[model samples]
Target: MTAVQRLRSAAVLSPPLLWTVVFMFVPYSILLVYSFWKTQYPIFVPAFQLGNYMELVRDPQYLRVLLRTLKIAGLVSFFALVLAYPYAYFLVFKVKRPSVRLTLYMAVVAPLWVSYLLRAYTWKTILGTQGVLNSFLVSTGILSEPSSIFLYNQAAMVLTLTYVFIPFMVMPIYAALEKIPPSLKEASADLGENRLATFLKVTLPLSMTGIVAGFTMTFCLAFGDFIAPFLVGGPDGVMIANVIASQFGAALNWPLGSALAVVMLVIVLGIISASDRFERLGAGRLT
Candidate 1:
């Protein structure tokens, strides 16, 4: 490449690289420093300490919360994947008009543009005692009284998060399914295989990449979600993020929160690594 071309390339890349170093790397470094700082009687002091990490190691509450967060994340991922597959298939294979397909896809993803707080709040209102759902049920004689069934519970949190995050799951799977050539399915049918069998042997195997991608995306979002749980989840529905938020905000223990944050980061990275390895293994088997 010419010097002018190299200069152009460097100019294009420099802004983003500089932004990442300033915004992401610098904040992370500060967070690491904060993680080791000691909390004084009324304020956090400059003294370094390992007590925060040691406390995390000894606390069963943190362990339980971490486990619960994982469970909820697993459930969210599972539900999102299972639900997204059919919708993705429809959009890719069943939808005929290109314009219509684009419109439908946008509809599925439009929720992302809405405020996250508003979405959670909407669910909270829908599930609340005097909310529209309860009013409708009572008027229709489905229930004589407004039951405390939905508001501020694990189920509510899961439902809200799943709804909020389904688009992430759908996009990847849709891309995967859409990339699959139609001739492959025709060939499978020509070989006397039924539709289900063809999908199982051909389409499904090829779509593994999207499944892995969707699962990773959903798990990461759900795992780090605090607002959903905070708004709709009562005490029992609290996740690791909520605990982390409390440590930083109400508890005023930045060190403990930072330690927990580090732990969460490790867990997310571990899951991603395992998923990538599994995806590679699956690809190897197919070949």
Candidate 2:
């Protein structure tokens, strides 16, 4: 390339590159260093050690919390997928009017306009012992008094997370489904394949890219979520993020917290890599 062309290209890329370095790389680099340090009473000692990571594996409480976090993340992803796929499919395919489809799509994602804390607290209010659901049930003669079944549990955590992230699952899947060529479906029909068969063979496989993206995103967000648990998830819903927060908060163990944060970051990166691999394979097969 010519000097002028190269300079223009560099100018276009430099802002984003600098933004990433300053906002993303630098913070993560600091966290990486902090993770290796040791914590003495009242302070973190600058030294290389694997003690924090070791404790994560060695301690049963941390292990349990990690496993529970995984379980909740998985559940939230699954439920979000179940709810999102049909809605997205309807928006992309079933809905006939363009205006109507656009409106409906906006409705699904409109909750995002509201504050996340408000959304979480909305669920808490609905699920709490004397909250909306309980009041309705009691008033309807379904129950003698307000019940506590809906809040303060792992199930509540999963439900809250699923509701919050369903829009994340929907948007990508809607875009993927919209991108699908009608000729592919027409060709499948011409070959005497039924709608269900064609979808199973052609549509679903083609949409795997979006599915993987949404699943990976929802899982990662749900896995790291601490606020929803604080608002709606009680004792049983404590996840790895909560544990990590405790270390940084009242526990005052920065090294251990940093180590936990690093581990979570690594896991998320691993998931993203796997999702990319799957997307490449799916694309290659479709091609």
Candidate 3:
């Protein structure tokens, strides 16, 4: 390439490359280094050690928390997929009016405009003993008094996460569903395939890309979230993220926190990698 052309290309890429290195790579590298160090009360001893990771493996509490986090994340992803797929299909296939579709899409995405903290707290209020739901149930004579069963539990955590992340799942699936040509479905029908068979074979397979994307996104976000759990998770809802937050906060164990963070990052990356592989395989099969 000519010098001028090379200079122009470099100019185009430099800003993003620099931004990534400065913001993303550098912070991650520092966290990795911190993970290997030891914390002595208020002081961080800059010495390499695997003690943090060892403790993570040996401690049953840590393992349980990690497992719990994974389970909740998986559940959130599954539920999101179940709820989002049909809505997306309805938007793409059933909604005939362009203005109506656009309005519906905006409605689905509208929750994102509100603060996440506000949303979490809203759920907390709804699930509380004296909350609207409990009051409604009591007033209906379904219950003699308000119940404490709804708030501060794993169910609450899962419900909140699913509600919050549903839009993420919906948008991707909608995009994928919209991209599917109507001609393909018509062709399938012409070939003597029923609507159900055509959808199962063609529509569903084609939308797997969006499903995978949504699942990965929701799983990672849910797994790493500490705020929702703190708000509504109560004792049973506590996940690895809560533990990690404790290590960084009142625990003041920076090295341990960094180690936990690193481990979580590794797990998330592993999931993404597996999902990418599965996506590739599905795409190949479809083609």
Candidate 4:
């Protein structure tokens, strides 16, 4: 309201506001321009036509790949949530030793510090024909030969992504689970509610926020990932991001790539918006 107060408020907000405009808004504008341009002959014309988007809609290959990416991301998010929920519940309610529990959580999240590329390549060695698992199986007389089932496939891609993103899922769920008051569980028990009933009515409802956050984070990462698919997905694991990369690389169609990116962006933003709406509704209902 006063000059001094206004100046102080402006000083506080300026850095983050400037950073968002410069780093986020500016880059998106450039990408938006590229998405509308045409790449034909030896020239990139500013045609302002929706031909690039039209091709993506009409072309079955692009549609299929887009659907495949969505499916894989959905599965990755689902599996990550399922795996994380129990571990988070254990940490929240079961673990009594604070030091041990903290150490265990740290160990699970330690892989986040490692290089993503290195993580992807680690799977390569483990899944190779004469890799560790194969060699062990052969030595144990469980298999006569090194099986080709482990490497360069959809299974490998999904598994690798899930492993890499598991921490993201766990951390959010843990944060959510931590918020649930212990007294709520005790109160439920005092009401003669069974463990299962109390959990369903109290713990799970309170932790729904974490599930939504984890799913959103995991799905976004898995959906946009190109490197994981490239290293592990031989043929079947190729997602929309891989197709988008090909357009810029061997496909040599920057316009098409930009178009695909725009489509992906739209879908992701739509998901976020939908999630936000659901979150608000859920919160309102809880209140």
Cα-based TM-score, every candidate: 0.92, 0.96, 0.97, 0.95
Stretches off by above 4 angstroms in model 3 are: none
Using alpha carbons, what is the TM-score of model 2?
0.96
* Model 1 steric clash total: 0
Clashes of 2: 0
What are the per-model numbers of colliding residue pairs?
Answer: 0, 0, 0, 0
On lDDT, who's better, 2 or 3? 3
Q: Which ranges in model 2 have alpha carbons more than 4 Å from their true place?
A: 284-287
Worst 10 residues of 4 by lDDT: 278-287
lDDT by residue (tens digit), candidate 2, 1-287 = 99999999999999999999999999999998999998898787899989988988898988888889999999999999999999999888899999999899999899999998998889998999999999999999999988898999888888889999899999889988998999999999999999999888888988988899999999999999999889888878788899889999988899899999999999899999999998988961442
lDDT of each: 0.89, 0.90, 0.91, 0.87
Question: Worst ten-residue run, lDDT, model 2?
Answer: 278-287
Ranking by TM-score: 3, 2, 4, 1
- Per-residue lDDT value at 35 in model 4: 81
| lDDT preference between candidates 1 and 2, better one | 2
Error of 3 at 177 (Å): 0.4
Best by TM-score, which number?
3
Pick the winner on TM-score between candidates 1 and 4: 4
TM-score of 1: 0.92
Per residue, candidate 4 scores C-alpha lDDT tens digits across 1-287 of 99999999999999999999999898888778888888886747777988898999898999999899999999889889888889988987789999978987997799999999999899989988989879989999999998999999888888899989999999988998888888988998998999999878888778777788788889999999999888988878789988988888886778889899988999999888877777666651231
